[model samples]
Target chain A: SQTIHQWPATLVQPVGSPLSLECTVEGTSNPNLYWYRQAAGRGLQLLFYSVGIGQISSEVPQNLSASRPQDRQFILSSKKLLLSDSGFYLCAWSAIGDAAFFGQGTRLTVV
Target chain B: AQKVTQAQTEISVVEKEDVTLDCVYETRDTTYYLFWYKQPPSGELVFLIRRNSFDEQNEISGRYSWNFQKSTSSFNFTITASQVVDSAVYFCALSCSRVHTPLSPMDSSYKLIFGSGTRLLVRP
Candidate 1:
């Protein structure tokens, strides 16, 4: 069985602070990883996705970035957070031509 | 470009009643995939079903059923004997399939474009 772990289920940070959210997958190798953000009452927007280490494709131009340092470790980061950056962040993984599996997600509030 | 449309913004139904959520999609590619996911108040997305473009056969899983119509570009989901546990926001998503191409980290075809979700509320 595969499992994804995401940290700090909830976080409250002041504006302009740096942010780091981690996601790691177990029981799978070379899996596709993705980062998504969902605003309140809105659909999820894809932020970034990676097929391998050191490779990332960004879907939107925003204040956040994503990196896959290892085969199963993905990180979402921001040098400075904005009020609009607050949302529910989710990490997902999938094999080629398969449906995605999602993590529990992190709720970040930028005050 | 690929797009998914879930027109029902919200729906309310009493327990034991039947409910259907609509999903319509558009894509230029002949080969593609459609998916439905559920997001409860807890906010984790749970994958419900996936249907390929070639397979129009409707599927039934327990109390859940899916209708896939390629001509109409619609894939609808229905819950029979709905319960409170089925209350959640449902999302429809689409992805294009590219054959024989190496899976690149930069390939846009590997990405899924999601639609604005429909929130389902089942009353006790």
Candidate 2:
């Protein structure tokens, strides 16, 4: 059984502040990790995906960036947060030819 | 380029009634995959079903079933005797299969292209 942990489930920050959200998966090694953001009443948008340590693919250009410092650890960060960057962020992993498993998600609100 | 389209934005139905959510996708690849996921008020996306392009068989799992038609490029999900617990936003996604190229045993799975979701509301 694999489990994913995401921290600071909910956060509120003043505009122009920095942001960091961490996600870690246990029980699986070398799993495909992804970062997604969902705006209120909108669809999930793929932000970044990592194939391995130090290898990341960005799906869209935004104020966000992702890094895989370890095989099971993925971090989403931003040097300066924008009001538009606020949304519900999700981290997920999957094996080849398998369905993806998502974490609880982090709700970020930048005002 | 792959794209997923969920035609219905919102649907409301009474409890115990049957409901069907429609999904249409576009991809040029011969080998691709389609999936349906549920996101409840908890805000967690739950995997429902996955259909590979090679298999067109319709399947029934308990109160849930899926219909796949390659000709129409549609994959639809139906819930029989729907319950309030079934109320949630449903998403349709598409992914191209990793063909021939032997992937390392540790390669991360390919990414899924997602569609705008449909919110399903089951009322009592």
Candidate 3:
């Protein structure tokens, strides 16, 4: 079975502070990884996705960026966080022609 | 452009009542995929089901059921005898058969475009 782990489960960051949220997948190799953000009462918005290591695609222009440092390790980072950056961030993985599996998600609050 | 629409923003139903969440999608590709996901208040998304464009057969699993209608371009989900545990936001998504090429910076055909989600509140 495949599992995705994301942390810290919750985060509180000051405005303009640096942000780093890590996600890792187990039991699967070379899987497609994605970063999504869900604002309160909104749908999950795709922020970034990677097909392989060092291959990251940005779906929407924003204050966040994603990296695939390893085959199954993905990281979402920001040099300076903004108040708008607060949201529930989710990491997901999927194989071709399959539904995506999601992690527990990180609730980030930038105050 | 492929788009998914979940019409109901929120639905409140008493326990044991049958509830159906509607999903409508728009896509130009003949081959594509439709998916339904459940997100509890805990904020983790749970994959419920996936249906391809070629297969329109309805599926039933335990207390959950999915209806896929190609002619209507809709894939709806139903929860029979709902419980408080069924309270969550449900999202519908669509993806085309087109392969993603990193060279093309503007193409997201290979990615899933999610709907705004329908929040279901099942009271016991």
Candidate 4:
């Protein structure tokens, strides 16, 4: 069975702080990875996705960006955090014609 | 543009009551995919079901059933004899076939777009 692991399950960052959230997948190779954000009382918005190493696509340009440094390792980073960046960030992995599996998610609070 | 609409923002149901979560989608592509996901208070999304455009067959798994209607572009989920464990936010998503082009930039068509989600509260 495949499993997705995300770190810093909960994070509290001051405004203008740097942000780094990591996600990794095990038991699968060359899987599609994605980053999604959900604001309080709102639906999910696609942030970024990657098909392979060094291939990242931005769904919505903002303060955040994603990078696939390894085949199953994805990282979401920002040079500076904004108050609007507070939300639940989810990392997901999927194959073609299959259901995407999500991680536990990172609840980021910017104060 | 591919879009999924889960109009019901929230639903409340008593234990053992039957409930249905509606999902409506819009897309120009003839071949696409639909999915239902469950997000508990813990907040990780659990994959529930997946259906393709060509298959409109309704599926039932234990107390859960899915109704896929191609004519109406709707895929709805029903829970029979719901329990407190079923309390969660259900999301409906639409995805055009993945175009695994490592060289090409991905567009909305190759993305798994999600709806706003419906929060289901099953009280015990």
Candidate 5:
């Protein structure tokens, strides 16, 4: 069975502070990884997706960025947080032509 | 371009009542996929069902059922007997199949995108 781990389920940070959210998957290799953000009372928006290490495709142009350092490790980062950045961040992975699975997600609050 | 439209923003139903959630999608590709997910108060998006474009056979799983009509580009979900535990936000999503092409696999076209979501509230 595969499992995804997302750290710091909830975080409260002041505005302009750096942010780092890590996600990792086990029991799968070379899987497609994705990051999505869901604002309050809104649909989820794709943030970034990676097919392999050092390869990332960003969907929305914003202050956030994503990186795939290892095969199963994906990190979402920002140099300075914005008030609009607060949302539920989800990490997911899937095989080719298969349904995607999501992590528990991190709820970040930028004050 | 591929898109999913969930017409109903929110629905409320009493326990033991039947409720249906509607979803409509648009895509030029014939070999695409559609999915339904449930997001409860826990906040995790749980995959409910995945249907390929070619297979229009409706599926029934316990009290949950799905109807896929390709002609109308609609895939609707229904809960036979609603319960408080079934209260959650449901989302419809679509993804274009990875057609044989010279483009790199890393391209984001194969990625899945979600609809606006419909919040369902079942009163116990």
Candidate 6:
């Protein structure tokens, strides 16, 4: 079985502060990883995806960026957090022709 | 451009009743894929079903069934004898198949374009 873990399940920061959210997958290799954001009562919006280490694709360019430093590790970072950045962030991993396994998600609140 | 539309923004149903969620899509390419996912109250997504363009035959798994209409470009999902646990936000997704191609930057490997999602509430 595979499992995904995300740290700092919840965070609150003032506007213009820095942001970092970490995600890691275990029990799978060379899996497709994705980052998504969901606003309150809204559908998910794709932020970024990675096929391999150091290879990242930005679905919607904004104040956010993603990095895959290791095969199983993915990180979402921002130099300055904006009020619009507040949302529920999710990380997912999937194999070929298979379902994606999602993380518990990180709830970011920018004050 | 490819897009998915889940017209029903919210649905409320009583326990043990049947409910159907509607999804319509638009795409330029003829060959593509469709998917359904469930997001529970905990905010974790769970994959429910995947239907390729060639597969028009409907599928019934346990209490869930999917209707794929190629002519209309619609994929709908239904829950029979629904329970409280079935309450969740359902999303319809579209993907472009990358067949027999090496995984590369240009090769689009099942990239999902999701809909706005429909929220379902089952009351006991």
Error of 5 at A98 (Å): 1.2
TM-scores of all predicted structures: 0.95, 0.93, 0.94, 0.95, 0.96, 0.91
Query: What TM-score does each model's chain B reach against the true chain B?
Result: 0.93, 0.90, 0.93, 0.93, 0.94, 0.90
Ranking by DockQ: 1, 5, 4, 3, 6, 2
Per-residue accuracy of model 4 over B1-124 as CA lDDT, tens digit each: 8889999999999999999999999999888989999999889899999999999999999999999998899999999999999999999998887465546555556678999999999998
CA shift of A12, model 3, Å:
0.9
Q: Between 3 and 4, whose DockQ is larger?
A: 4
Candidates, DockQ: 0.77, 0.56, 0.60, 0.73, 0.77, 0.57
Interface RMSD of the candidates, in order: 1.2, 2.8, 2.1, 1.2, 1.1, 1.8
Residues B85-122 of candidate 2 have per-residue lDDT tens digits of: 99999999887767324355323236787889999999
Number of the top-ranking candidate, with TM-score as the measure: 5
Model 4, span A1-111: residue lDDT tens: 899999989999999999999999999999889999999988999999877799888988799988998999999999999999999999999886578999999999999
Please identify model 2 stretches exceeding 4 Å from their true place.
Answer: B99-109
lDDT string, candidate 3, B29-97, tens digits: 898889999998888888989898889889999999999998899999999999999999999998766
Q: Candidate 3 on A1-111: residue-level lDDT in tens? A: 889999999999999999999999999998888899999888999999877898888989988888888999999999999999999999999885579899999999999
Cα error, residue B22 of model 5, in Å, equals: 0.9
Clash tally, candidates in order: 0, 0, 0, 0, 0, 0
Q: Model 6 captures what fraction of native contacts?
A: 0.47
On lDDT, the stronger of 3 and 5 is 5
2 against 4, candidate with superior DockQ: 4
Candidate 6 local Cα displacement, residue B123, angstroms: 2.6
